[model samples]
Target: MKNESKELATLDYPGGKRRAKLRIVSDRVATATQGDCLRCARVAVRNLIIDGSRRTLGRVREASTSPGLVILGGNEGQAVRECAISDPCGFTAVHAREGAKLNYPESSPWGWSLANGVSIACHNSIVRDNVLTDCTDTGVVVYCSPGTKIEENHVTTKRRSAIGGILLVDAEPFSRDYSGIMVKGNVLDASGQAMRVGIGIGPSVLSDDMETIINDGSVIGNHLTGDYMGYGIATAGLQGWTIRDNLDDARYMGQPSDRCLDDPVNPPPQAFIYNSATLKESVVQDGFFDSDFAYRECVGLIVEVDVRVPGWWDAQHLENAHSS
Candidate 1:
């Protein structure tokens, strides 16, 4: 059988929800056999080989459908349990459709993420139990998905342009705009920026119209560290936003600011508040533009900061990573 494709099976849940169990295997690499393993839902699949690169993982979407669950597997060691969900060399475990839910079990022992893992561009889904490190971009990016839930994940990117532990993009293709989302219970550390926004990512008519707004969401109980760029929790092109109880965004200078004033246009701004949290120096500081970005008419402005910094020097020293 061709292993580099999705294996689909139907399951019956009593009085719950109509759910399908799927396992993606690589035909070229090691393939999984069928068995009654307790780890999966029912009549589960086994032994999905971890192929060398991202192209192998894309095969899993061969038999894609609607709102089913996806689990990412890897090869050797505790990689299925220890490393980030996918290899850092490329974008792995990516399935983009409308209305899909997925989960990845990961571990980050290195204090930094080495790859990108388990990105879901679908709408109205949940992403949980993921540990991502060293990804050059976002750990998990959500684009133009309404009523989405991003919870209980750890993202650490030590590389350049490391934006968004869990990013939300409401850009060009998002015709209806992005609203009613929740980002809660995550650890984001040492990335260039955290939770960036932009949208419209497909062969559709409105992909360019995705630059919209987000509304009616919550950002709670996240541990944000080592981001001297824009914000711990940022929302662009939206209104009616809420950010509460994100206490871990700190600085070495001992003071915390809400945001490091950066580019204002393109990605619009959302509401930000510091709750029972601390702020130092400036709750929101500015002039934080990407040194490499060549865009025109780009000015820097910081807004809606919910600063959780403990002291002054703690927050100021965060800039050292860039100058070096």
Candidate 2:
């Protein structure tokens, strides 16, 4: 499919209706040389499974604005599973936004998302075993949803403006706190940021006293590598979040201290953790580093944490090389 705004396929179920169990398998979906707002596929119904081992989905044109696969909505009991989404454009490969029911309810209606001004929502969804490359924004984006899992995926990007491999944020004003978000077993190799989980500043119609949206989740066992200009992992406005067992090799692309923040008086460390003021009960531990020790040693206090230097053989390869 090419030059269209609508998705190639969309499975949507209306509110207060019987949920549909749909399966889109073994199909090749692509949008090339298209205009704006072009998406490969979308699933809004419940109990949807998209699994095609040989399936290829991409947007070869740079004009594409949306993701390759979009999950708008799903029930709590039903789960949406997407596998093998590959080779997307510079935009997000998989995007799950605030759904219509969440935004257009009769009791209380809220405005569209502050990030992209779109209304979509998803829950109980799992994105796994996918390969996404050359994404401009992010490989996977989950906005204001609960019980979402992103696991076992490989993401790479050449664009330095790219945000990260996986980005989780709260953009809507839902009364309930976003929870059960898990990121694990993924290889994120990018020129910019690697992984970011946080909440943006937005007006919330659901609560008058809520200032900052908080997410309860965990980021674990992911291999993150990126340029020195960005962070391997960044978190903000999170509660009860744990970041552990992850490997980071983020370093300057050119010079040791080039484009990095330098402190003349109090220098930073080689590997360290950052916690925002709004972050409550969050812990970062057991972090393994395979970064450029020579660069860190030269910078002297530009990094604060102690890093373990691996052998030459182990340092030569990235994590899960075959998967990426």
Candidate 3:
């Protein structure tokens, strides 16, 4: 189906209700394109049980120069699940450029390949209340998008070699400025998944000589849970970014222990520095990063704690890996 948006378009289940008997199971479900991106900015997709699509369940590709595209799932937690979905990047809902709002409330996107389950590649957008699980790559990634909010979402890694749960990156090729962005109130779980990092702020896996400047940004009130996780929060080269009030719930080497702020020599193992970068005027305070776990080194060499000190610690240089 195509939505030119000469008029507002809404594709929904029968009677605008999600019934178990109703299904939109197809190899290609729906694709909405805005021929004139300036005139229109919203497409509502609701109550759809889109199953087994080789491509995305709902796709919107509009002109970046145009206003924006807002793909709303359903009203007030009525969004249904997109299961057994596949694509080159495994995205259940796809949009392009800036000013896009992806609100998939209570929607679960699973069984994807080689990419993020929910990707907000544009700036000036909002992504909230979606649950991502078992995706081959990251769960939710807001790439180069400033003024964006990633909130109240749940992400879990059940797939081995998954690349973290939630990530905010300047990314590669287009290391745009990410200012006024907020990542708050999200839950990331890596249980026995050997997940790489819980939440991270850095360059993409292939970024080189690229610096992502984030001004007035904040990562707060988020929870990272797991035992076999790598870094609860991994960051590098941040300025004007607030990293606080985030907690990790993992056992100390698989045994319960009451340890807070281990010695700098034996620092808390949940937070780390990924690469060499200057961190100036950023606040890292009032958080809990459990204790050392035997599987703490799951992602290889990393510097733990002291992310506020400039050049105090630096670990592992980024190499050009396959595009994620």
Candidate RMSDs in Å, in order, are: 14.2, 13.5, 12.6
- Best-fitting candidate, measured by TM-score? 3
Q: How many backbone clashes does candidate 1 have?
A: 44
Cα lDDT tens digits, model 3, 25-121, are: 4333333222214433343333333333333332322222211111232111111222212232124333343443333322233333344555555
* Candidate numbers, best lDDT first, in rank order: 3, 2, 1
What Cα-based lDDT does every candidate model obtain?
0.35, 0.37, 0.46
TM-score, each model? 0.47, 0.49, 0.61
Question: Which portions of model 2 miss their true places by more than 4 Å?
Answer: 1-97, 100-120, 159-161, 173-176, 191-211, 226-229, 253-273, 286-324
Best-performing candidate as measured by lDDT: 3
Q: Mark the regions of model 1 whose C-alpha exceeds 4 Å error after superposition.
A: 1-51, 54-84, 88-92, 99-116, 158-161, 172-177, 191-211, 227-230, 252-324
Q: Candidate 2: deviation at residue 163, Å?
A: 2.2
lDDT of 2 by residue, 1-324 (tens): 222222322355222223232222323332122211233233122222222111132222333343333233322222223222322222322334443222110000000111111122455456565555433334555565666566776765432223335565545534444577677887776543222211111112111222454657778888766543234554444567777887766553322245233432112332333334545787767542322111121221122222233422111100111111
Superposing every Cα of model 1 onto the true structure, what RMSD results? 14.2
Q: Is candidate 2 or candidate 3 better by lDDT?
A: 3
